[model samples]
Target chain A: MSRTQRSLQLAAYADGEVAQAQRAAIEQELAKSPVALREVEDIRAQRAALHRVFIEASPTAELSERIQARIREDRQRASGRTWRIGLASAFAAAAVIMMSVRLIGPELWHQELVSPPPLVARALAVDAVLGAHRVCSTLSDGTAHDEFRVGQKSIVEANRILKALRAMPKEGAALPDLSESKYALSSACACALVSNCEVVHATYNSADGVTLSVWMSDRPLALSGASKLRRVSGEGGRVYQVAEVAGGYSIVQWDERLASVVLCGEMPADQLLKIADRIQPFGSAARPTVGPRVAIVEMALLRRS
Target chain B: MSGKSFEEIALPHLDVLYRYARRLTPDAHAAEDLVQDTYLKAYKAFGKFELREFGVRPWLLKILHNTFLNGEAKKKHAAHSTEPQVLDTARAAAEIGSVEGDLRIDLDGLDDEVKRALEQLSPDFRSILLLWASMELSYQEIAEILSVPIGTVMSRLHRARQQMMTLLADYKFRGRGEPPNGREAT
Candidate 1:
């Protein structure tokens, strides 16, 4: 080998990364040439120095937790989209039944067989007509908390949204453990009245500008009109959902474990479902309550079931 | 496939990912962001990951490296207009004129000097050196992670070491306010 080629081999040999034969060749060259020997020594010293100087600092405990949390949020967000689409299709399929029921009679009442649980039915009926844009605009108009931002600001706004939804302690600065639902926390919110009941309007936008707006309320929603609904099994239980397209947007409305949720976006029904599926109740305080209205809806449904 | 499967296959490499990310990024915050983004992307694409065909470590590193490079390219593109290229000509002239100095590089303060020098190298060179030296990843594995040939890894590693030595030794020469020439006459 030429001197330059031999020298490169010496570097590999110093790192102990060379083959057995190449190692022997390098050792022989080192013995014959003092300059080559010094080069090898220098390389070894450099490696040693790097090993000593470079300290592999252990990441903080928060980092691993943060990473794991972010991953969970991501998976939920993705599957949630799929679930939403599935729910939407199910809702669309139920529409044919809606037509059949109309022909059959008022015999098959929405509450009797087909409607989702009560709160989900009520909020969705109102959400279909009353868009979340007005809620966001209300916040932007300075009637509520301002700064309707996304991404980094979403972290703070997540808590703000939970508070608006009454899902957390409304006063304290201590943030809820949101690693689970943190992915959908990417937007702003305001508590706005829909059909005479207060609801939290939270709009979460992905980094790529896909927006999923959620309308949530603690009050059990009563089905107002001949609402179309479908029963679909979700992560926790049998979630009732409504999927429809109106005003150039696709919307999915469902009952989460904690609140009645209505999700709207300019994407496919499935994409809207993905965001809806990820919208977990933030704290222990936000569990769904079986109120008198829900009891009445359940009684009517049970009579038919 | 399942959350348990994802945790089992991928979460074990979190430390490795974080260490390498620290080397790639400027600070802890950026490193955390890079690793978080990498894991999220990996989890999303886990359906396509064939664990039996390729190991998780190399796959995770590839994601981390790609995410970092894309962020870097974006920043470069953003700053490209504002950055002055006139300094390039001046720097090149100064590099060519550098002569070997007699001052021996002191090992006393080398820990910090070596670190500064490592950071001074381009991301490509620094990455190869870190993968080989710190992470102890094999050339074959690095080739897969970097999507480069084994021969290319070897050459880049050698050049990286040479450049590092030059930078480390040159620190003393530079302290004297002269052009650094620890470049050996090969």
Candidate 2:
């Protein structure tokens, strides 16, 4: 090697970076040349001087304490972030469960534990109407009833009962006029056939003495059953439950203006629904109608076997 | 890793790291800051550290080197208008034997002329000289710490020694009231 190359190797040699074989070679070259030996000595002297200069400069005594404090602070901040993330996750999970119960629990409950409200309401209406029809048939003779006095008395008695109960129909809604169907309004009174809630029982008699009974309640009646009933869509997008009761009676039940109305008779189901379509809330022409809104607890009860 | 275990294993190298940091930075406060940052980073990344044959000193040095470079980069970016050109001119002047006053003082012990000569070296050369002398790290270990090749480490150390010797010679001549560059005092 040339002198410059040999000189560069002396640096690595002084640093003790050369392999054992290279160390031996450099040592042999150093043995023959005073210039190479002096160069190595000068490098060592400079290295020692640098070591002494820097080794005397030490950090403050509190540097370690400061570093440890910083580490502790960092760890505390990380743990705080983890806690916040965990709390947020728990709240999010609870909200998801509540929304799930609100939106989907009722449907599953209806499918598994109880029949839907329309079916139970239909059956109850069938029983109540059948009983009322039997009572009215026994009470009334085959006489052509005076329409004006009975209609006027029906209104007076309905108002008196509503006043006594401290309840009013949402918009002055009264019994529908079924004169166009040849059924005259016969007798109207309050009865306790469906639950303890007061229900208005109104009977309409045709010229041939075919008896039809209608039941109206200010709130939804609570009923439970296992049998599903058929629903029919009527005019103005109203849904009606049509079902046949014992002793050849057909029932048509629907909701109007926060009141559940059930109409049942010994007539055909179609004829009953046609009569139902003619019924409307009496006072206001512009009152908005809403579908039945059953609470989740009310819809989730299991039917008694 | 647990903090206690990390302290047991790493705290012994605090003096070494601080010494090297002093060589790299301009002042004791900057050096302490650099050492604290190095320890914080090391603690965060402790889980990924494997106990190698060279131990944790080299690893800590690597973090210190990287943190110092990152700080320098941020400073360069913030002072983008004139700082870089000035640094370049200072480095060139240091190489050609004309160093500014600020780079010539600071660092206690030893002769004032020797301290000035030591301070006149650039950061890269000073780092190599410090690691090789004070820490006694091999060329391979220094290369690993600085993220450079072993050849570069060797050449930089050689050049750094040469520059230190030249600056010491100039300072010695000036101290004797003689003009530099082989001039007679008469």
Candidate 2 structure quality by residue, lDDT tens digits, A153-235: 45445434443333333324565667778887776655444444446667788889798887777655422221335789997
Q: Quick one: best lDDT, which candidate? A: 2
- What are the per-model DockQ values? 0.15, 0.16
lDDT of 2 by residue, B58-102 (tens): 988877876675555435433322232234435644574542111
Give Cα-based local distance difference scores for all models. 0.57, 0.63
Return the interface RMSD of the candidates, in order shown, one decimal each: 16.0, 34.7
Best by DockQ: 2
Model 1 / residue B146 / CA error / Å: 1.3
Return the DockQ of model 1: 0.15
For model 1 the local lDDT of residue B136 reads: 65
TM-score of each: 0.50, 0.50
- lDDT by residue (A1-305, candidate 1, tens digit) is 76546656777787777999878977887899887787777766666666655455557899878877787787677677666655655654575467554646544333333343333333334332233343332221121222233334545555543443334311222232234533344444344434445465555545554555666665444323223444445544435354444344555555433245556666665655555555554334333433344546765776777
Candidate 2, residue A159: CA error in Å?
70
